[model samples]
Target: MGEQPILEMKNVHSGYGSIKALKGVSMKVMPGEIVAMIGANGAGKSTTLMTICGIIKATAGEVWYDGKKINKLNPEKLPTMGLCQVPEGRRIFPRLTVEENLILGAFHRKDKEQIKKDIQYSYDLFPRLGERRRQEGGTLSGGEQQMLAIARALMTKPKVLLLDEPSLGLAPIIIQQIFDIIKDVNKKDGTTILVVEQNANLALQAATRGYVMETGEITLEDKASALLENPKIREAYLGE
Candidate 1:
């Protein structure tokens, strides 16, 4: 068998109330690889990430992290287990300073000194954030808020990073910058990433492999290059 996946979701089924958001969806991310799940609106991409993060409990099937079953794991305990997520919207604290918002991301850890270093590292990654360290998170522009979101998630020092719609509502230039930083994080930190994005082109460009989801189920799985060249993918997601 191939090396075990760092993160795996097997036949996961989850939804809100009676509305099924995911229908037995299954996928995996190998160590040090960037995996993207791409689909249109209401196609269950965001739901998949939320389920994996335990923010939305799975009603059936299993989620595994480093070979440990984690479907039943509490969402609050995930960060300590080296799993972190940057949700779709940049949900930084509106009233808190940028620095304070980032510090909150390390709430589960007790390494005070190391936390300080990581904060500086985050600032280095996004100098805009460093310049606005004392500014309220709500005061930053849309692009800056998105940067802070990614930076905060990095503070957790995750082994696996789950990103939902990182390219949403930003200018092309800012989106490119975000994806570039994402690849950098994967390479430098060796963080296994499972990103859910509506921008299939960008996602495929950033990932090693990708899954195509439709109406709550994955319909295609292929290497990123293959998916990017596929005629169907081009017509549907890449806007060819």
Candidate 2:
């Protein structure tokens, strides 16, 4: 097996016009690892993911994925490279049926048989989505919408899944369930995941390793278990 990380960002700086969000942020996600980025609101966690996925142009530094420099690639082409994001706010198409939303994810692929199988796998991963396969995405409850968002991304058959705020606006029980499913997806599919989460305690628990971001920079990174036990991490993020 190759030694390079599935995804790597080196000194990436990006943001909207005249607003720099990520300032020299560097991180990596190795194949099959569930890596979490945790921080408070406006810490630039989502910005890092967007830069890696090519949604926002990196004004400086490099983004490497699967042993290649992809900083200049278009966002539309990243999915074909096995890089996909389940963006924040559960951005499922409100007017589209759950199945249609899923179909949209695989629009780039030509493998009919595998796509069908993956669609069924999504249903298996989220049974509630299957129950409402033909229902409009907007009709689903908050938790269900979150599930659909994740399932839709999975349908792309990504090698690395970038999940931003997967637990946002979710009930505690639903958050637990979502984390469980995320863990299962990583374990079973061997998908490398880079997750930005506000729920630091839960994110650390589910991750193999984690990076703590503050402002526009990465402030701490370690084994998730070690980070969880860190006094500073507990004091600031874990609410202890």
Candidate 3:
């Protein structure tokens, strides 16, 4: 691991109005590693992701990405800095073609040749997306849309990918497939990934390190294998 983390949140605090979602939450993701944030509903997992992506601003502490303080940067600037987020719910444009959606992801880039190459790369990664390139985004299945969402994020050529609940609402087999692709992306592209998931087992399997959050606090942080073996984790989150 590098001396400086690729992404870091130091005692971050944020929420909607008076409701504080994150209370002194701190975490870090090193280069080329998959780090997971696992937590129950309302535990601030999603908030943390949004905060880091600049969708939500932190009232306290700082968010550092690639040695720059990004806590104050607007959301639009994040993609340009090699930070891309696939938000929850697979938010694809319903009326747009699959290719159009992917193209929108690279709107900040001016290099047409590079964009073309990235589009091809994304298509190669998910053949289904290529097959449905002309189809409207709403026509795809939930699993296919999830794939599209990921593919669109990848079109930005992000150095650090922040994935929020990629497995939500998908079939078990599809979830497995998505996780496999995520691992492949990390291995092949060296993209640092920070994933927030409710599926503890799946997240741990894909990540090298994991953190367990509860009620806006991280109660456990350890190696994925260690967390998987923990009695409390198994009983509380793993349903063991």
Candidate 4:
């Protein structure tokens, strides 16, 4: 058999009280690969990440992580298992300084020495964050907050990091910087990533493989390069 996926969702159906946001959504992230899920807003892209993390329960279907059924697992317990998420809005602890916010990402871990090293590594990954390590998270610019959110998530040293809408809002230059760091983290740390993005061009550019979602269902899955060149994707998502 081929290598088992680090994370897999088999026909997961999830929603908020009577609203079925995900309709039989299925996807997989292989080990050490950056798989991007690209879609428009309200396409259930974020819901997929939430369902996998157990923040939103799948009404029907299975979520498998590291060869185990994790659908029923508590969301709070996920971080200890190396499942970390950087949600859409870059939700950092507003009152906390950048360093303190990053420290909290590793709260469940016991490796004191490695945690210190990872913090420095996060700095190296985003020097802008390092420059403002002592500043309150809320005070940073939108792009800086997004960087902090990603950097904080990295502190957990996840086996598969779920990133939701990494390019939501920002200047073009800042968005490029974030995508570059996403590539950097994948190469340097070998961190497996499943990034959910509405910016199909940027997502596919950074990914090795990609899934395109529309109205809560996956309509396309292919090598990122192939998707980029696909005429339909170019028209619908890339705004050709």
Model 3 over residues 13-55: C-alpha lDDT tens digits?
9999999888998888999999999988889999999999878
Per residue, candidate 2 scores C-alpha lDDT tens digits across 1-240 of 248888999999999999999999998888999999999999999889888888899999999999999999988898888999999999999999999999998888899999899889999999998999999999999999999999988888899999999999989999999999999999999988889999999899999999999999999999999999999999999999
Structural similarity to truth (TM-score) of each candidate = 0.97, 0.97, 0.98, 0.97
Candidate 4: C-alpha lDDT: 0.92
Each candidate structure's count of clashing pairs: 0, 0, 0, 0
True lDDT of residue 202, candidate 3: 97
lDDT of 3: 0.93
User: Model 1 — which ten-residue stretch has the worst lDDT?
Assistant: 1-10
Q: If candidate 1 were superposed on the true structure by all CA atoms, what would the RMSD be?
A: 1.2
| Global lDDT of model 2 | 0.93
Model 3 is weakest, by summed lDDT over 10 consecutive residues, at 212-221
Tell me how many residue pairs clash in candidate 1. Answer: 0
Give candidate 4 misplaced runs (Cα > 4 Å). none
